[model samples]
Target: MEPGARAVPATLHTLRKNIDSIPQGVQSVVEQFSVPRQQIISDLNNVSHSIGFTIHSLLKEQVYSVLEAIQGRAQDLQNSLHHLQILHKTVRTLTHFQDELGLALRDRKESTVSLLDSPHCTSCARALGKAQSLEPGADYSRVPSVEQVLKTLSGLPKANFPDLIDQGNSTFNSMPDLAVAKMAQVVQDLKDEVNKVSKKVQSIADSFPVSDYTQPLNDALMQAENKSRPYLQEVKHYEKYRWIVGIVLCSVVLLVVACNLLGLSLGACGLAMREDPSDYESRGEAGAKFLLVGVGFSFLFSWLLILLVFATFLVGGNVQTLVCKNWANQEIYKFIDTPGNLPPSTNLTQLLNLKRTLNLTSAYQECKKGAGLWDVLQLRDAYDLEDHLHLSQYTRDFQKRLDNFNLHFEEIHFLDGAGRRDLETFRQSGIDQLDYPMFQAEMQNPVVRTSLEDLARDLEGLRKIQRNITIAGRLANESQALWKIQNATVLTQEALVVKLNESVQFLSAMAPHLQLLLKQTMAEIALIETMLPVQAQRLLRHEIGCFTRKELGYFSQYLNWVRRTLTEDVASCQPLATALDNGRVILCDRIAEPWLYCLRGDLSLPHPPRYSSQAIGRGLRHLQDSDSR
Candidate 1:
């Protein structure tokens, strides 16, 4: 029906040519028959165009649009047809990689740290997941059966399974196993610095112009501490069905095979009862070959239809994995694969005696593996609360407070240093009234100017901190920690905290000298205290930045790893998406496309072009002849 509608415009164009081509004899004969009409041919041409336009517009809206939509859907289904195969390849790769890792971890568990149990393993898993575009727990439900994957493997050019396993092994071996020790060392270092800083701050407090400055400092602390703090916000962790993924893959193979072959098993049992397989071995190899051939020929004729069935499978599978399609980002992420079971931690201490197991966290269903980066990039929200913690916004404000305090504390000492030199110079000038060169040199000195400029530059560094900071950073709740560090907010906050802490101990040691300056700079001290605690929620916000960076230490290590292994990692992950894509190209060159869907939505054999099939047949014969030689 739609084809006929499309034909209207072409028919009208043909009619126009026909009217123009009429010979003079035919025109005069037609003129006598239509003598009453003026320019009959032109009138007929106009009518034909009008009919063509109406048919064209009607079909454009009612027919072509609907067909286009249907075609689009068919294209999507065709592309996604090989989704199972992709999952299959992934299952094989991950299974191989996981087994190797698990074994290597077991070997190490007896000696030192178990890679299987460490948070660092979680970090590695996170990176591997992103690099491969698979969210372990989130994507488990989409994993195909071991059988399906094995089928795909049979057709694949052998994957670099050894290389993948070696990479996994190397990655784990390269990982720093003594994370606890490192954390302990970091904590100890922070403690030493804190203690040293506290003593200096306390000494300054001792002779801190008690009557004039001490009261103002206390008032500032009080004001800052009294400020209200925001509630601590945490990410809502999704239930990870990761552990079931491997189990589901194995179970699929079993269930599918079991359901299909139960009758075969029963028939085999009946045959065994009649005669054991020992009877067949009693005969010669020739007798056995004869028996196998008879069975093959019988099954061949019985299931001759399966050839076309398998051909359809080939066509369908190849279409789904078309090389031009972006299945890596699209189809790979579409379905949720079945989850896998997580093995019990080798490092975890199990109680020998217990009435019931103690559950420490509601995240029992959570997979041990880390989430991937794909989820973070795919969210629709500009700044979803789910993506970040409350501490993100609070960190920078805390750093600002620290900066203000440091500036005031250091400024007082700096001014005192400059003042002492100035006072001594004045006394010397009085003693040596004839020293004109010394006085002239003093006029040329830029001591105060340099000091003021340094202060401004340091203050400007603090100013630039917030300007570079962004909202996206503070919220890397469940993100790929390695990638999340790129956020300006995270970097800026970290920089500010480190900078503020750098001069803390040195500035604190100037208590005795600061006594004179304290009275002079009391307002500077007062202003810092008042602003620091109030804007930063007193101490909590600053501590949040400190705590966050401690974890960032782990993220940094992972980023270093990715940099080193990026090429290898890309090579490792590329095979699964590309494995089956070549199926179509190979088929188009070697196999014949015999069937197609007709316009009427029914299956039909395609009409061959003139001598096309004969040429293809000849190509196949010539290829066979060459192979035989």
Candidate 2:
């Protein structure tokens, strides 16, 4: 071969040694921008995928969280709205009830006069009068009527209606005749009002749904659950189906073991059959015949060996001998003795010659009297010992370090020594923190050139200056504009309230009709008074025509009923009003929460739980301090 040329190394040191050195300025001119350019390209290549991937995952996780919050809040809002609507309907029904009651009251004058003339009303009034005079719980021989019902329901003590103050007739002297008569009309009015209210309640219930709000709430919660469930299910189902797959795999392993055992048995049988030369063909026979002979012989011998090994000594047998020739049959045999023929001839010839009642058979047959697998048995006993020891660490270097640490720990077992070691450990750990993942990044995150708190004085000055600058001044102008708008809105609300008061006054001014023939009833005057109208003052002076105890009692009962109805209506509507108010407050608070949190720099939405990595040295120090305590 011809002599070959040698190539020098192209590495940095080799290159510098071989090539001439350039001056500093020339070098900078040659590679300054080029090296940075290459570095930029390399950084872009290395960081682009990581940055994009990280951002994508972060965005997806944040989006899911946002969606979950939205769905959950939507459900809350839906429930609030639904309940508000239901309450609104209830209020509307109550208003309708009030309207119907007003109509009933308007038409009751004629009905009142007729009911006052009824016999039942007179009887009830007389009973009530009698009751007022008699001891409590005393029985009177009178049938019950509407007056007794009212007297029973009134819950008042020793009060009498005007009907009981009869002046013209002696027969009606024991009764509050006028009041009892008027009560029948009141009863009819009550029934009509209850019926109308019932129908309204039923219609409202039918129009609104029982499950509409509940179903939406459930769906919203379910949607939140589903945000994480779909992907999580892929992982969760792995545990579920894993059990099934494990079962299948276990079955396959068992089958393989069984097949292996069977193959071993077949091979052993073939070897066993070869011990019998008579079963084989002649040496001059064809190769096919040998194979046929071998297979046939294997099957025959395997069956025979199995029969003897398993069936003969089935009591305590080791049939493993059938598979491996090296193993011996280990079966226990039970034997029963029989007299010899020689002994029979000498002393028990009669017994030997006599017919036996039971003919005893082989030990295996006598024990079971059944047909099954064959086997035999042989036994041996032995024992062995074992040592169970494992290395604490796999690699020599790690094990050496572990052992050294153990020795170091032993030497520093005392409190003072241990504390000194702890400090040293902490010093080492502090150095280790420099290599901790994201340590520098985490440190950089909480640091700033100028924190908001530190820049407070500067911020004030900037604010004032920004008020004059064109760009930042817009924000100041907008803020002022918003304040102006809010003030205007307050003024507008006050104006609206003033207009409402004026409207009420206008309505009150138009209350009395300019007709002399038509006189307004006290009830009409009373009804209008609740409207907060100024004209209601006329009710005090209205001619009710010679007011008596009976008339006064009648007015009290009516007013009591009206007062009770109004009380119940107001009571029932309070929760609805409260709920609506709370909903409004919650909406405002929720709207303001982010803004307030942003201004304070304290917003922290809930994310999935994770293990937070603390500084190694800090954690160690904390643990040590806690242990010392």
- Candidate number achieving the greatest TM-score relative to the actual structure: 1
lDDT of 1 at 369: 22
Number of the top lDDT candidate: 1
- Mark the regions of model 1 whose C-alpha exceeds 4 Å error after superposition: 1-36, 39-41, 113-629
TM-score of each: 0.15, 0.14
Error of 1 at 351 (Å): 99
Give the per-residue lDDT of model 1 (tens digit) for 1-629.
22222333333333323323223222232223222122322332243233233323432332333333323322322222233234334434444444443343233222222221234332233222222221111112232233432343233222332343344334323212322222344334433433343333233223212123113323433443333111101111111232354355335434434432442344344334434443322232233333333344334432433454466656644554452132333432222111222235421112111012212111111111221111211222322322222223323432333233310111111123333333223222221122323322332332112222232233233333333232122212123232232232223332432332232222223323333432333344344335432432333234434444643333234334432232133112122123223333333322222222321245322221132335435644543453344
Clash number by candidate, in order? 18, 26
Question: For model 2, what is the C-alpha lDDT against the true structure?
Answer: 0.29
For each candidate in the order shown, give its overall lDDT on alpha carbons.
0.30, 0.29
Candidate 2 lDDT over 1-629, as tens digits, reads: 00000111112122232112112222323223333334333432333233223323433343333333323322332332343233234323433433443343233323332332334332223222221221111111111112322223233212121221122122212122322342334334333433343333233223322123224323443454445344445555665685775466445444444544454454345435543443222221222233334344444444544453344344222222232111111111111124452343443213212113222223223223321111100000110101100111112232232123210000101112332232223222222112222321222332112222222232233336442354234323433432343244323333433443342233223222211101222222233223312221121112111112222333234334423332232112223223223333332333233334343455322221121224323433443453344
